[model samples]
Target: MAKYVAPAISLSPFTCPACGAYAQQIWAHAIYVQPHANTNYDVAPLRRCKCASCQAYSFWSKETEAQIFPRAVASPMPHPDLPENCAAVYLEARNVVGDSSKAAAALLRLCVQHLLVHLGGKGKNLDDDIAKLVKEGLAVQVKDALDICRVVGNNAVHPGEINLDDDPAMAGQLFELINFIVRETIERQKRLAEMVDRLPQGARDAIAKRDAKALNGLA
Candidate 1:
């Protein structure tokens, strides 16, 4: 028998960012459980939910219930702290490197830039890494984006054998690596944003203003 258990409790209630209303229907009360019936067919936990605002009813099985469905958190609206200009800069640099696929390279660049900005006051000089990241605009860091100008990006462009067309798979692999970097970096920025929000308004304004010393918490 598959031993499965529902979460200890329903997730915390959150106001929907979209509709700006309490998402009461998200509190899942019914969880499907397998009966001690024939072991042949797997009995999964199930859930039924009704949206009070939308009047929509949905059914879910045990397997799907475990997945963080009806995500607990709502995405925040765009804030002023982010560097809006960097998006265009990322795109222009990617164009230099022939980033033609779905061409999300720029967004990946933005993701890394924000990650580094969040880490600005912290970590080693990392300025060389930052310079390279800003210049190259690629996710060279397997662990962190600072590894980019530190290694991959410039090295990949080294003048040895220009066989980019011969093996297009390399491009795909690079894109995939960048995609991972972008995904992780974006998540980090979200958490950091909340942290920044908790600080006093003066501190928040300093960081939002991109006051390097202020962001570093020096002042």
Candidate 2:
């Protein structure tokens, strides 16, 4: 029996997909040192990594330079208002976006539905849910864009609802639209909270007074 040690795995360049963090730790190694005529590399090593930010585990193969299994990372979202299930679904969608556009699109559509439900919007289907968001004050332009996502997602899941090209670019657009909506709602609230927290005592009192008066219908 012989003891084997792999060189420290580089956490640079490759980002942890789950947490959007650059830091990682390797806990195990599998290395193959056989000479091969098919490949140029002399050694093949597979390293197990745990992201420092999210503590999620992934295995990295040196030859492929990629996480071989669970190929998708759970990258952090900008919006605190996004539900946990939606975030997880978004990550899964992102992971498959490069390989399967239809699957990603369907998951992204589900993400939108989860977000709408989390935000107190309800409907029998994704289209109705999106309409509920518009009724709740979502901008018309955003609603129009979301409707496109709804249709695309429906096409992906049901097939032939619409003639879809099934391209990665279209999947990317759905992902981006969901992110935009989350940031617009969740991050905006966080920023506003931060601003209120930084206000001067006198300003805070004045704002509170105004709010109280408004609530009492006296303002």
Candidate 3:
């Protein structure tokens, strides 16, 4: 059996798996001392933490067992060279529509979604960003030029009355969607190459000179 103890003091805090993003910046407290013989309690009182980027609360002990472990560290922002991982999710959503014609919009959705997923550069809220792209970006322009076919991507998964084959508006939306994605992808890719200057000096010179060898080993 375990013995009962009296109220105790808490001390300075470390990064909370729970909080970092508040405007004021507070830490979720970590307990350094505990009752000597208590076996029933798995964790201490809840403390608030904020997401450093979005300023969301970081709840303590959401993963109780996970609290005791280590996770591999990776860069906060994924390299610009690897935006394809971002594109993959959009492609996945495209497949959900089950039409080749949908590819263009699917690609666009992927771009918007990609930007959203990486909104913070830490690559957080990307899903939220995708949501905004659909709701704010695509849906906003529906009556004007964007059309609403792309809404099927969002609607099909939810309480929407639209279907892919039955709706031409959806088709038009898909067209606009594709154009958006392709333009953004090309721009970002170009921007990344410029930023990194990743190509060899000869490769850069070749591209500058319209050299066919810039096609990568194409003789």
Candidate 4:
């Protein structure tokens, strides 16, 4: 049995798994310290927190000085390179991967869709969407990799298609592919923007002039 405890003086803000919102005003509605006869660090409290943004509740447990462990949201933080829509769907897929592989795969497919849209790709389906990326200057290898993910997700969601088993290894592979795409696409743009920001004003103006001339076919 565990004993209830008053929450510590300072409660740090954490992201909520339910709504994918960063919540600062998390109130510990209930907290219980687990019974531990061995270690001093076993003083970690189990807590239920309510998010102000979405008004959704989440659970937290297992604290370390270096790391804060909240329920499903802890293992993998949403990628900074992912767009908001893709990140939300990616997190949803992660949350349910253990219970339903098919559902998770469907959510992952949506993530791919969001990514494609972010890249200004168009298609009637995911395959065409991937092909559009290739036409728009994405590397062939990356497009091929994304195609495989799309195939798996498509099979998982189809009515008569064979169901994908809840395989952790397979899920991990899909996530790895998604992470790579995000880095290659969004992160590259971020780096370029940062580099542009650091350029000298004269160099920036010169580039702008060159671009304008090219646009006007006067270069």
* Winner of 1 and 2 under TM-score: 2
lDDT of 1 by residue, 1-219 (tens): 111122213432333333334454564545444588544432236555555655544444556444234432212222223345533444343443344422333343444444465534222344544654456454445445345322333334443342444543333344334434544555466778788888999978776688776668975
Local lDDT at 44 for model 3: 65
Model 4, 1-219: lDDT tens digits are 011122222354555455544555465534444576442332336455666777775555535322233434232445677888888889888888767777777888888887888887762477777777787788876787688678778877785344577353565467768877877777888999999999999999999999998999963
Which segments of model 4 are wrong by more than 4 Å?
1-75, 159-163, 166-168
Give the residue spans of candidate 3 off by over 4 A. Answer: 1-82, 90-112, 119-150, 168-179, 185-219
* Rank order (by lDDT, best first): 2, 4, 1, 3
* Every model's TM-score: 0.29, 0.64, 0.29, 0.63
Q: Scored by CA lDDT, what does every candidate get?
A: 0.43, 0.67, 0.41, 0.66
Residue pairs with backbone overlap in model 4: none
* Model 2 misplaced regions, further than 4 Å: 1-14, 23-81, 161-166, 215-219
Q: How much does candidate 3 score in TM-score?
A: 0.29
Cα error, residue 183 of model 3, in Å, equals 1.8
Q: Name the candidate, 2 or 4, with the larger TM-score value.
A: 2
lDDT of 4: 0.66
Error of 2 at 186 (Å): 0.9
For residues 96-157, could you state the per-residue lDDT of candidate 3 as single tens digits? 43344344344544444455443332234444444555654443432223223335544544
Question: Which candidate gets the maximum TM-score versus the true structure?
Answer: 2
User: What are the runs in model 1 whose C-alpha is more than 4 Å off?
Assistant: 1-83, 93-127, 130-150, 160-163, 172-176, 192-219
